[model samples]
Target: MNFVEELRWRGMLHDIMPGTEEELNKHMTSGYIGFDPTADSLHVGHLTQIMTLIHFQRAGHKPVALVGGATGMVGDPSGKSAERNLLSEDVLNHNVKCLEDQLKKFLDFNSGPNSAEMVNNYDWFKNFTFLDFIRDVGKHLTVNYMMAKDSVKKRLEGETGMSFTEFSYQLVQGYDFYYLWKEKNCQVQMGGSDQWGNIVTGTELIRRKAAGNAFAITTQLIKKADGTKFGKTESGAVWLDPAKTSPYKFYQFWLNTTDSDAKSWIRIFTLKSQAEIEELEKEHDLAPHLRILQKALAEEITVRTHSFDALQTALKTSDFLFGNGSLEFLNSLSKEDVLEVFEGLPQFTISKDEFSAGINATDLLAEKTTVFPSKGEARKMISGGGVSINKEKIADPALILNTENLINGKFLVAQKGKKNYFLIMAE
Candidate 1:
């Protein structure tokens, strides 16, 4: 597979230094992309770079994933309006380990000749003294050259102004490339287009310091068709970690994408072939309401980011909440999973003793919980066959709900109509 051609067809290629494609075509070259350990978990915003590395490895080249432990402490000023709060060494260490674990899920580290490798910038920077860094790296790049970077110039123009720590981040990042080139024979650096300046600085460092040739390639920064940020929702960023963002929510995030974004994102995020994607697009066009494209994108990405079982659970969860799915699925869930399934719904707690003794359906929905505004409304809804408990219709307003109705021995799922849901917890 041609690496540059793959990126280009997927609309991922943004900028490529001269001869980058020619160099890649000549032989299996090693390249690296730096990931900052600012968070314990990588969000969907980082998927572009992750996909880049995946493609790099798929093209039979060595892919080096550089986790920025030392540089993370200084914080990159690129695309930032203010200086970030620096994390402690311990926190940065934890984040780096977490990132490594996540990256392993997508890249093969055991393949011979062109396997992926993980590196920490701190491994080299930890022993190098500040004086040594200044003399060896700092002296190579002039202040004018560093200041010429868009990342630096924008910060200098910002209201808060840039800090010295952030100001020197390009130099630190540039040195990372130099060290990798010298030690690991990594020839190329890849990242989002915003990092073009930092990446060029690295190539320039290799030239000035060792007279070595290096290359740079950057992918497009993804954004929504509406011009808002990608990977963000009403709740927050959709994270790769299931603990931070539930598999169900993660699935919904992709499944709910606009038709336009889904068409573009499927190419960039999934490993589906061009022919297969074109087929899916034809089917989607025939039935836009079916959201064929969105489902394909969501299913492929969710299973890759998580697991097949997780995708199944997310599908069942969606059905249970939105369609006529069974209670058996809910019964199989843990307490935490159950809560996650009903995460933004209204919830109310009732006494365990009261629930054991049994409460009238109208009373349960009205006085005990706010599923209804009043008993009259609850009775009205129940009489109209618009209320359900545990996926069963309430036949009579005076129907009794006891401990037997509890799902997983602690909760009741309530539905006001076809859509609105509520959680009744017995404690």
Candidate 2:
């Protein structure tokens, strides 16, 4: 269970300080990765760092999950092109607590010797005065040294000059490492490739301030094979919170990974052994149309991030929508669950009074709603056996629908062909 080797084999290793591997191998060293509370819920982009910590702990080392309550206020400028709007204390506190709860799900916090622990920088930085920080932290790094960082250098060259607050962000974050090192005996700091400069600053602070050695390692930043940003869809980031991004959508996000991206992500995201992944890849190659790789990746991740039950529901919903299962499955689901399953599909609303009176199927699809452009077109599709309501084929153009036809008494699931889906909501 060599941590460095594990990351290397998975193509996750990006930057490692000299002797980092030796330090990790020598003993059960304590290591940590910091997460900022920039949002109430973490997105898929944070999964890599979460996986890094998981691997660190799996290798029989103490893993610490640090929440950047203090640094979050200042905001890390690592990959940002411009300044960000600051969050208030109440909002930031809420976000920190939310993120802490999410991180706890990925690691074993109860195991004895090498158990995971959560720490908040705000706990210490809350009472520290600016003057004290300048004397203790700012004194360790020179302005020239700080300005040399790529994050700082880039901001200086841009029209919107970097602010003093952002410039000192690295120093604030470095102190967090120093504090953890001095207090928790955390030996190594890990993060995404973009945080290399900030991480090194911490190690340097340890050496120059206390003549102590600290190690750094960074994993590759996840990106799409198409060169677009990872973890983002047209709606925005794919959030970890089921409330923000439903389990179905979250599952679909990974299920939709491109073949090339799946080849790489399967290694980084899943804890499957090399032999197991290789076997899956071989099977996937045999039938690319089956999307075995995408399915494996999605199932593993969805189960871990959400739950086995969630994965089952996502699968059942997928099966029903894709035409592999019957409408009875939809009928078996609760009204809320049914709506969740068809979240992204087209939906139309009709007055409850109009719906109770029972409308003609053709009128419902053509006039009352827009499932088809015209009554004639709707009739033709119905005749061709290409249309369905509540999972049953529309038998006649004049067939009536009303409250009795509504699943859970509020909705009707309409299907056009095998793929196109529409939801008719009666309120």
Candidate 3:
């Protein structure tokens, strides 16, 4: 597939350097994308650029995943509203290792001569003295040119404003490119549209220092149709690490994509080619309820970033909850499976003595439980038949709480309304 043209057509290519396509056609060339190692796991925001490299490699070129181990400690001032605290070396090292592990899942690090390689900027920057940094790499870009970037411009707009450390981020990042250009013969750098300023600085640094050629490419910053930033859930960022975000929630996140978003996202986020995506879009238009585009997007991303087995488990769990499966079928799930499926839901704990002491449903809903803040409100809901236990509707306020209603022998699934679910675990 023609990677550049494909990205352009799908609205993924936000910027590309002159002669970039010609350079790609010449021979096996190397391109790099820098990833911030500020977090232990990558979020969907990082996925867009990672997918860019994946597509580059598929087009018979080399891809380099640069861990921003050095830049992350100082924090990039370009996009933030406030200055960030620097991370300790121990934390930064740990985060870099974690981010490396996630990037390996998207790109082939062991295939072909153009195999993906992970490099940490800290390796080269660790012992480089401040004096040498200014004299060597930092001297290429003047403050006037650095201040022109939109990232720096926006930060300067804010009341808290920017810091010198953040102002120096682009120069530090530029050195990574110069380092790669001199050491590894790497040419192109790609990232979200926001990275244009920093990337062009890299190219400029190479021009002044090494007198070498380099290119820049950027993908469209993934944004929601309503203008909200993508990659965020109500809880926070949708992390690749299951510890921060569960596999079940992750699958659901994709499955919940909107009709308009699924159209573009299906192509950008998935390995499905132009023809396959078109067919899925046609099928979705034929019956949007089935959401062929969403399913394809979810399935491809789920299996790729996660695994077929995790996808299956998440799908099975989703079906049991939202599909034709009944409460009995939900009860049939293992305690572990049930917990995993509903992990994103709110939870509470109550003691066995509190549950067995002839406490009425209203008391259980408020005092004995933690769903509502007051017993009077719980009574009103139960009397309105708007309360449920294990999905069975409840109308009586005097109903007793006992082992009979508990799932897994010590827990009760309570719902105040159609959408509110509270898990009360009695020990």
RMSD of each: 1.2, 1.3, 2.6
lDDT for each candidate structure: 0.94, 0.93, 0.85
The positional error of residue 193 in candidate 1, measured at the CA in angstroms, is 0.8
TM-score of predicted structure 2: 0.97
Please give, for residues 53-112, the per-residue lDDT of candidate 3 as tens digits: 989999888999999889988897756789988999999999999999999988998887
**Best first by lDDT, ranked:** 1, 2, 3
Clashing pairs in 1: none
1 or 3, greater by lDDT:
1
- The runs of at least 3 residues in candidate 2 whose Cα sits more than 4 Å from the true structure, single-residue gaps closed, are none
Give the 10-residue window scoring lowest on summed lDDT in candidate 2.
322-331
Summed backbone clashes in each candidate are 0, 0, 0
* Highest lDDT scorer: 1
Query: Across residues 1-427, which tens digit of lDDT does each residue of candidate 2 receive?
Result: 5999999999999999999999999999999999999999999999999999999999999999999899889989999999998899999999999999999889999999999999999999999999999999888899999999999999999999899999999998889889999999999999999999999999999999999999999999999998999999999999999888889899999999999999999999999999999999999999988999999999999989999999999999888888478767777888788778888789998988887898999999999889999999999999999999988888698998889998777888899998999999888
Query: Candidate 1 on 233-321: residue-level lDDT in tens?
Result: 98888999999998999999999999999999999999999999999999999999999999999999999999999999999999999
